[model samples]
Target: METNLLFLWGTPRSMSTAFLRMMLERGDHEVFHEPFSSIVVQGRTVVGDHTVTSHDKLLRLLEERARDHRVFVKETTEYDYLSTGGDRIPYAGRHTFIIRNPRSVIPSHYAMNPAMACEEIGYGNQVEMARRVLAATGERPFVLEAEDLLDDAEETVARYCRHVGIPFLPSALSWQPGDQKVWSRTSQWHRDAARSSSFTRSEATYEATVDSDRFLYDCYWHHRPYYHVLRKWARTTVAA
Candidate 1:
């Protein structure tokens, strides 16, 4: 098990990139943004100074970094990254998750990639990943709803920091607006996030709604149940 390692696994269009950006702002942990997706989408990914070309090598690199730094990795379960052969979920770290309503997730995703496959919506994969994390860790991984995150960013993030055994950094809730190198590969999908200094609601109004697109409608219903399954364990609101 890699000590000082943490993971935030999530579904697509779930505001996870924003979450990672906050982690980057904290300046306390070494962060990786979708290292798995980088490999799957572009054949190779550069982690720090190392060029990681395979899943095994990437895992090894993360393990090495965990020895000296508190490592935070944020990734989505899209593209069947979890389905590739032997136990893919790195069981060494504390795992957490974030999710959004499919009604919102589907439409937002469709706008970015009209050819979006049902699996790319990601709730099903999240459910499976959570189960695997629980089986390995003997506890349900902390879960966050994107709605809650956007509604009360401070409270949600503070709760998450407590759950993961880190100090709540209020200042990390905001950052200077700029493009991050980590988001360059998926720049188009993250422009809004890069431009924001704080957690704000996504303003992308999509023409591809569940009401209008049969594919998106079907995809929503197909993965909606899994969303509920994970939501069952989502972090509860703290009392004022």
Candidate 2:
């Protein structure tokens, strides 16, 4: 059997943790969550079970993990910190990009971290990483939209499974509500997701208030163009 290493990359508030939970329920792949966040935010050397800080070591660890079992790693594009204007990690495997509209992502992200920078929002990094993955693998990475995934969880997830060469199991559509073993208690976003038994459409009203907050409004514009570039390629029902 061929061991697989799948990377699900996204920006904050893109429903990434929730997707990670779904993947965890598959019960076949070894799942990792936010292994690179600490390195990007704190300049730390260790994240989760992987202690090596350098990009080369991290890639080697991933390869080692996948030697016997399929590995699923859900991380954010903020790990662009590992890159110096080139491919951050040299390992080649399935890459999936999860994205949310800036209009939705910005307000929720701002609420979580009021001092968030445009760079930390990660839209540009997501795009850059996707391009690098394409150039390296000569394959277009699967692109998913959080809204679409919520709109039709089964269909969207089925499409995702087919795209990534995983078996489409209905059981992955939902999981027991609460934090998975992989998440840290420090992430408020993951905590909120852990509270859900299933994917729920975000009812948080940001549209009405986004323009009122001058700083947030500007940040939204900063991420808008980058969001559109990926949104055009996002996998939706129409594509399915």
Candidate 3:
């Protein structure tokens, strides 16, 4: 059977890892977490237990994997650093863009990497990728807000699964808390997510402090408009 590919792309600190974990729990698909990221960080792609450094070779490997298994991939938009061609890959798959409010995403991302650039946070890239996917498919790729997903994971994820033509397994809504070889173990964000078995509402607020950090504040405002643009088209309830 030809594999059905599903790409779940998101910005930094958007609960993407948690969502990826949910998909992994389903056991119905072969899940890949940030394949390009592993390549960029380790200078190679790890196939099964071996590593391959050639980009063309890596694509061929992925193609082979997809031929026999349903594949679910989750990655941040920051992978754009690796190639301009990243957007082209999802044209063959169903794509979903996940976003979070900059008020929350900015502070969390800044805490991890003070030197992080605005583009690295990924709001602009998410919007651009969605536009590209829409143009290529003549259908808007689903947009999911992190806050909404966390607010009601079961419902949100069920709708997402339906839109992507997947069976909505109750098992996919939760998972064991720990690291998976599929993701980068060195990432602090991934580590934090690995500690959680399920999504929970955060009471955290950063608005007051955003104005105090000049760089973060600027990036926050710069991306806020774009975030809203995507939010306007986001899929929230089933009616949407």
Candidate 4:
């Protein structure tokens, strides 16, 4: 009867990784670690861009690992380019968009992947991405903020549970952002893997940044037509 799946879409620096740990720390045997990661998703089987076998094939593998217990799916990705390549499968599941103020996100993503420009991404545009989703994409994910996930953990988690059709597991509230109980070192892909406050929700809003009023911040990831794709991502991430 455990028929729920969770697909979280957002940029690299958002709290989706923390959210991943939250899902794993639970006692459900059906809920496995990230089945879509680079390791498990490809492994010896070797799945690539246009040649993805199918999520059903992946689900079968998890079911094999879990014996016969019910299995749940969990994955996190950016809003704009998710449907491309083999990521279309996650879009078929119950989904949510984890939004954080891009000010906090730019710094956090820089911390995790320091090769990008720092001025373009922010929470405001993450919201704009969500609105574009209704107009273009075939997906609709509930929107919830990283700040709320931290400040109002209980309510935020309950809302996520409600969206995914899972019973609210109180234990998910205390789930640490990077606990080993939920993941091995290989599972995490963030900078300083053990600890980094750059992803915090406290100062995530535009108000937190000095460039709030600027016409343009950074222009690497948020450029022209593709920029609208980010809005599409936000629309899918926004929770109903």
Stretches of candidate 1 off by over 4 Å are 85-88, 235-240
lDDT of 2 by residue, 108-165 (tens): 8887777778678899989988777777777667788898777899988888888788
**In model 4, which range of ten residues has the least summed lDDT?**
43-52
In order, how many clashes per candidate? 0, 0, 0, 15
Residue 122 miss distance in model 3 (angstroms): 1.0
Superposed Cα deviation of residue 108, candidate 2 (Å): 0.4
Q: What do the candidate models score in CA lDDT, each in turn?
A: 0.84, 0.76, 0.76, 0.49
- Weakest lDDT window of 10 consecutive positions for candidate 1: 231-240
The order by descending TM-score is 1, 2, 3, 4
Q: Write the per-residue lDDT of candidate 3 for residues 1-240, one digit (tens) a residue.
A: 124777888887888988888888899888887776666667776777658775455555666777777888787776563253344564566778888888888898887777788888888877887787788888877888888777888888888878788888987677788888777645567766778788876555654347788888888888999898888888443346
lDDT of 2: 0.76
Q: Which of 1 and 3 is ahead in lDDT?
A: 1
Reference-based TM-score, model 1: 0.93
* Alpha-carbon TM-score of each model against the true structure: 0.93, 0.89, 0.88, 0.59
Model 4, residue 227: C-alpha shift (Å): 9.8
Q: In model 2, which runs have C-alpha deviations exceeding 4 angstroms?
A: 1-3, 42-50, 82-91, 206-208, 235-240
Supply the global lDDT for candidate 1.
0.84
